[model samples]
Target: LLTPAVPTLTGLMLTGCYKFKAMKMDVIGVYTNKMSTDAYRGAGRPEATYLIERMVDIVANELKMDPVQVRRLNSPKPSEFPFATACGLTYDSGNYEAALTKALRIARWNDLLDRRARARQEGKLFGVGVSPYVEICALGPSKAMSAGGWEWGCVRVEFSGKATVITGSTPHGQGQETSFAQIAADRLGMPIEDVVVLHGDTNVAHYGRDTYGSRATVLGGTAIVMCIDKILAKTRTLAAHMLDVKPDDLTFEGGRFSAKGKSVGWGDLAPAAYVAKNIPPRFEPGLEASSFFEPENFTFPFGTHIAAVEIDRETGEARIVKYVAVDDCGPQINPLLVEGQVQGGIAHSIGQVLFERTVYDEQGQLVTGELMDYALPRAHDIPPYEIGSTVTPSPSNPMGIKGVGEAGTIGATPTIANAVMDALYPLGVRHLDLPLTPEKIWRAIQSGADDRGGDRIPEADRSAPRYTAADVGDGALQVGNV
Candidate 1:
């Protein structure tokens, strides 16, 4: 909002190129003086989201409103579909209230609040937090990419009912193999097992670049849709040739190109009739198609997450008691895959809020770079989570899907952090940093004396470092050296 001169880091970050377009709006940005950049896992979106949900708890404390009620009052209404926010991004579709309410029900929000109240009366600490998130993904078509220097995909499907999809998109473990195959199977009317998806090799694939920004489902899937259409078109032609019928007379369904109202299956006419007597005089017997799709706008997927925590005031340990997420990704292609994505994202979020961080020492050398030092949450640390979704078909795509990949992470971090903060609010604390360490929480409790009057500030709380660094003096670290 405050149109300061662009920072150099903006030029360095690929996402920063889109920041200029954002500045035309009429609001003030908090981090204007600092250089901005985008990292993997959509750091900017997640960070700001964490900040906002944290602030919601702050407001709830001040107004004495139930945190859930406060959030409901401030949240975007469901009627606000395709709504343009002050930030200039257009949200395609969402029902924010429904998602939030459903998540609360699944988490038993009221029951937890009662428990927390009882715990507080018994001089224990308990809290619950909810984070509703909206993220833009599935980057639009070629024109949208050209404007932001974003990449689009090129995909091809070959003849002989065998598909070789060459996608410009690459997967670093987002399950492109499973989900993309599902899309191809449904699109081509082929059994899910029959379709083959190819990606990641720049030599073989065409018109794509590195994958990030949660664009794979939107952009990459569009490319696949395009390729499938061409393959279907050619298959229709081949069907006409083999059935001695016009291309228009042949219809595709359930992996079979059939003459409508006839029992003959398209699979029954093999490469023989397709290549020999029954085929049209000039048309080829084989089938194939390829294309580049450019969408006009980005798809926005939204969701809500709720977390319940039990805190030990003595040790300053916060344990998750319950978790629930209600998401709407706009017509899910695979329900099980969507559930997995949500669960994985939530785990990452919980890790960030409670245990995970990257750090460096005064000399700016990498420390805690190894997994032994880097804390990732294990299964034992996580409580069971209940997940549910609502289907709102996207108007933008023919397939009606919006990406669900990052929803849980974007929603869970703040939810867990807020719950922890709510549990400690009675101890007279307001703000804290990520990875809410036991030492940090214990110190905060001890340093906080009975409040006499006005708020206190010591420039900043400097004792709680962002993260710990390894003491690797002389450019080396040693363990139990035998």
Candidate 2:
């Protein structure tokens, strides 16, 4: 929405940063009579990353080179921190090799080499694939965004030491409230139950962008910390006066202020601040602070995802035997939350490449609008992810956190696609597009209907594609219109 054209839709993420000589990306935005296209789960980065990752495997097969070696040779190293790619963007800091190495270990790449040899001898389809991907997140450098990209957060402490945080990023179900509370409680040295996070009411809260582009924790959480800083500064002055010591001499821990040999609990100190009794000179009467924090640069969250799968040559069915993901979204505040995000994103990505496809017919209508026609992956369709991580903190943010919400989705699409291609490579099949249905694989094996482009299925009802009232102008849906 910031620009007339969706610039990043073509080439934004690490596609431009790969350092491959004489690399060119050609992108075209087309206008169709069907429904307008917009962001999917991972948005532009996933599509662009998937394309290049798939091409890397294709080039490896053509050159008789190992895919892992090919990627390792091309990926930038730790020495190249803040390196700019041919695509006209700079990477702040990352260790692509470390993440890839961890992913390989989790994926058991060494064992896969032996498995491939034995599977070939036994006439079985077995393969391993990897996609090392980086996504530009925290959608910042507000100037580049051309509008609103900052977050607003405010913190207020009651007289009883209870705290309330209001963040601009309203999260529906991302567990943002719980994470934000954790940060506040740790910073204030208070019990977690004493701190509460609030959002969803813009009228009562400050103004900023809502939760999209995975900006909640990195942007909104940081904003809350900044606001807490203001409160702490005011409280420290009050705390010092109550302890009868200099502000610098007072130290805080376990919700108590200690100076030399004297200490005061938050329960006693908090109410004293508002009471204006023995308060520090020029100190405020109540604790309330607000901060609108704009991230200096966008966070680049990178990771490697590996997939192992075996295909049934007889019926052209694909089964994911094992899946491994090694992601580094910087210092994780909660490991379970990070793992859950990776798992959910992997499921979404795998679904897109295997079962889900938005199809339009010759009449410019959506054929898969209903669940009966649409083929989303069910519980049985997706495999469990074995997740691991290597912490390579970002230097851009104070918390050194990079966004992980979209990392799994960014890495999984190509990993699964490559695994399928690896399984079919012995049969001379190299490249294929998404929604790798059994019919396409069987055709590619038997008669070489090499999968190209997206779903090409015909409309189920063979009816006219989306002919809305605007198109009819005169609003006439007669018997023949069907």
Candidate 3:
């Protein structure tokens, strides 16, 4: 079976930053002798981002041009969105240049360059890397997903004048409980403490497209909003009946319905809904609603990440001195939650780039299968992050929310890898595979060789292979021997 990662390879890769005239992607899933690969954090997005961002740096280095300038020249302007990419996906909304500019400003880009120069004078390796990335998320419309791409939410007002929200989107630890409650409470004009959110139980929420691809807030929260609207419509009609006024004459505010100097609060309305005594004609005797929200399209969350690193010439140990990330994931419901998600995601990316690795011997047996053998990042390994955001509300949903759960992971891997490459570039190291371990860096520094064991070519003399006319057919360029 083709996993979600397959389409992600093409859909996300070509649309990260640049606007390509034409593109093609071929997926060849080789069945290895050992275990099969499955989805991880960011799925295929991190790999796609790594490929494009690394190529941007390579192109910049070869042409002696600023990578930032190259990116700006290729990126679509803000007015150009709902931009359709050559990869057969349309971006809902973004301000790629704005995110990039904010990240650079926060990182003090020019000052970082000067610091690198000074470090070089002191016989140190200081490198700065920037990666601007865009990820497709909010799971999406049913037409695009095989399993179905809708979320379920139910809101029921209890007799106690409190609300209970049951969502189909399961939250392991993304703080959906708090964020969803906040969303529901605001719409109901009730105290947040009066709302209770429940999920992760199939018996409770029997129908839903559970959370993945950062759809909890966008798809799931929108579903809740839809349910709330339905509940309010019924409540207004019932309230007008109780007040002996037209539904249009009744206004709702602060959990109360008012008409002509008379008002009824949720406390009174809830009991009336259950009692069924003199309620609205032909109306249901309960205050509850359920919704299944299917989004029109996926949300596009873009961001810029900048990393500053210092490499020890003798030990080949790289230390991240500074990190800045500026993301645009639409209007945040809770800024603190966004920051926590980004910070956790960056830590996950750092582990993949610098520490975590899986190994197999020539005999195809697992080697680093245990924690003692494999590595994971510790708290100290994560550098302090400078978090920032630019709001570009998505047009795909009523809440205008985009996803942020995977943005840091999607952007940080390339940013950190590029920084390490930049630091090793002066030592004549052209390329190195991850996880950029200390031994690998030291070996590369000593041999001054590329990953393929070729001698490093000078910038002026180096040349990349060109695609011929035969390689282009129907505006698509097939890469590799697949």
Candidate 4:
């Protein structure tokens, strides 16, 4: 499916940190006689990041070089902004080294090394892992997207001096309402409560790209900004006419327009614009504007995530003792919202790496069809997160914001996986597929085998009859014979 293929191709192109002299990729979508795969939280980004980060660790182990040094030696310098990858995408702006530095400092890299040594002395399998990831977001130019890449925004300053922002980008739990309000309030110099954000209603917001690929804030918010700029232009003319001053002479700030000695606030001018009296000649009656913003290039958000993992020798259980995430999504409109998104994404990553999995039988029947069979990370499964940020503004938009929606998921998956792999590397385990289960780890430790293919159930167990729910009464399910 196009949905699956897009991310798959994206991942294939972005599988390495170093600039390669030559590279080739082939995408062959085959029918597995199973349900079609589609986009997930991080889509292809997590898979791509996992591939590169694990390979980096593997190379480090082989060369006896520090993984950090390997990264530093190969990464593009900060001056290489608008850097073009050999794979055919141009990064808007980034400071990969800065993010890495911040993450390492926050994670206390030296102390972590000492701790790992001490744990080893105690006969423990302790390891530290670091992953620096850059992901393409804000969708891109319209030519690259099957669907239109631009987003629409409408801003209307009501007669009561309150504002309403209608955007095509629909926000689910990413808190776009609050963030959009913040943007509008800050730009209009009005109270945050005075701005109301509306979306996800087709009748209200007739046109939109509908908020995927972390384009809500970058594209949609920028559209709102464009609308605000248009509205301000009209307001400036109206204020200049009313104040009997040249438009260039009037300065607008704090919801008020001021001249040499006279000023007009929103309360005075908003009603005047509608009243059509004492306003600029040929001025629009309503204080409203709409804009559609199409970004010229994709904004690349890069970050570094470090994880300290400790494995129990006896049980094969791996626990993350510490985690540090330093991300750069340009400037955060709301730090709280960004933090919440990152925390949720990190939890999602943790689930994907250690717990979540989908299984199938020889007949292509779904084995892990329900939540009871598929394990998800619980509240206690997450480690305390040390979150930090670097601000490397993208030139794609005036706000300079990239997207943080998928940053945590993209960065944390490989960070934790690399840590687990690092711990197993000492035991002669070279490679393993995801959802590093206890049994798999224990078997690897015992046999020194690589489970790179995936978890395989014994044929007898795979063919065994399994329980399925029939009808349920009184909240009790009746088990049906398989």
Model 4 TM-score, all chains together: 0.91
**lDDT of each prediction vs. the true structure?**
0.65, 0.77, 0.84, 0.82
Q: 1-482 in candidate 4: lDDT tens per residue?
A: 55556665465446455666566666666767788777778778888888878888777766656677778778888897788888788888878877887777787676776776677667678878899999888985799888688999999999988899999999999999999999999999999999999999999998999878888999999999999999999999988988999999988899999999999988888898888877666777989999999999988898999998988777778899999999999999999999998998999999989888889998889999998998998888899999999999999999999999998999999999988877765456667789888777777766643333333333343223111111111111111110
Regions of model 4 farther than 4 Å from truth: 7-9, 12-16, 449-482
Q: What is the number of backbone collisions in each predicted candidate, taken in the order shown?
A: 3, 2, 0, 0
Order by TM-score, highest first: 3, 4, 2, 1
Candidate number of the best lDDT: 3
All models, RMSD in angstroms: 11.4, 12.8, 7.1, 11.8
Candidate 1 weakest lDDT stretch, 10 residues: 473-482
lDDT of 3 by residue, 1-482 (tens): 43635555545565578898887676656667877667777888888888888888888777656677778788999999999988888998888878888887788776777777677667687788899999888986999888789999999999888999999999988999999999988889899999999998889898888878888899999999999999999999989999999999988898899999999989889999998887977999999999999898999899999999987767777789999999889999999999998998899899888888889999999899899989888878889999999999999998899989998999999999999988777666666778888777777777763434544646443333112123222212121111
lDDT: worst 10-residue window of model 2: 473-482
Quote each prediction's TM-score.
0.80, 0.90, 0.92, 0.91
The global Cα lDDT (0 to 1) of model 4 is 0.82
- Candidate 1 on 230-342: residue-level lDDT in tens? 66676576667666778888767777877756633435544544455566557655454556656677776777788888877688778998888888888777788889888
List pairs with backbone clashes in candidate 3: none
What stretches of model 1 exceed 4 Å from their correct place? 1-38, 141-160, 244-249, 260-278, 281-285, 449-482
